[model samples]
Target: MRIKLENGKQNELISLAKRNLTWKELAEKLNVSEYYLRTDLFYEKRLLNSEIFTKLSKIIESDFSKFIKLKLEDNWGQKSGGKKSSGRLKKVLKPEKSEELAELIGIILGD
Candidate 1:
């Protein structure tokens, strides 16, 4: 099933998932590369396939239907800016003192 998520709902889901599971664990559960989850899904705002959405819903222990907006149509325009931006991922400096700060940085980098 093709679906469009409500605005910022994907990021919200990712935050919820991170609270309960590490990136590695979530990647394994979704059977996708961690890079893809971090880069494509989180950063690029790619739409989720039905299988992955179902797994993510289960992993986050929430009903996903409320977050879904519409069944995506073939000609559905990009909800993000129409053109893809070109750039390299910025280097993140390691956090010195707090692990929580580090994790938050990681989450932002993923976006």
Candidate 2:
């Protein structure tokens, strides 16, 4: 499962992990791409998977995993299809409107 640490703690952990190594060198040790390590994890931060987080903890000898917590993210994905207008709108609705509808139609028909 993907996990997240508190942002402050995660940044502290990343700083510790960096130590003297450049991101490219650190990524090489972790067998991942520097772009992913730098951009994905370091810059555009998101949930890190268990294995990667474990590796980082081991590499830095720092465990911030306890700071991690699960949240039910309702905003995680997109919702499709929604009411495009203010509902039934100013259009035909009930059978009682048929007389008004016919009058309106007659006006359009040039009657």
Candidate 3:
């Protein structure tokens, strides 16, 4: 799941985080990169992992959930939907017999 906060709330979260702790400190505590928090999550306001939001919510002592919009990442387009390969293997084994095997078969029949 991903979390996307409202426009105003985006800046609010950043201010709260800055007041409570250093940006680097917050990133370290949350086990994420500052680049991700600032660039994608805050500035670009892109959908980010809900796990990060949950952890940040705790540190900032705020419930940003009300403004949040959840986006579920799915591979619907990429889903195989049981069509993995070209289906069952070909049963044309006769054509694959070695020349020696064919000769042996003819010898056995006295051909």
Model 3 spans with C-alpha error above 4 angstroms: 74-111
Q: Write the per-residue lDDT of candidate 2 for residues 1-110, one digit (tens) a residue.
A: 56767766666666788898998888887788988887777752766666777888998886676888753244332322233343645766666668888999899999
The full ranking of all candidates by lDDT, starting with the best, is 1, 2, 3
Query: For candidate 1, what is the lDDT?
Result: 0.76
lDDT of 3 by residue, 14-35 (tens): 6687685777887787788888
- Candidate 2 lDDT (Cα, 0 to 1): 0.72
Better of 1 and 2 by lDDT: 1
Which whole-number lDDT from 0 to 100 does residue 91 have in model 3? 78
Best by TM-score: 1
Those runs of model 1 whose alpha carbons end farther than 4 Å from true positions after fitting are 73-111
- Arranged by TM-score with the best first, the candidates are 1, 2, 3
lDDT (0-100) at residue 66 of candidate 2? 84
Candidate 2 TM-score versus the reference: 0.58
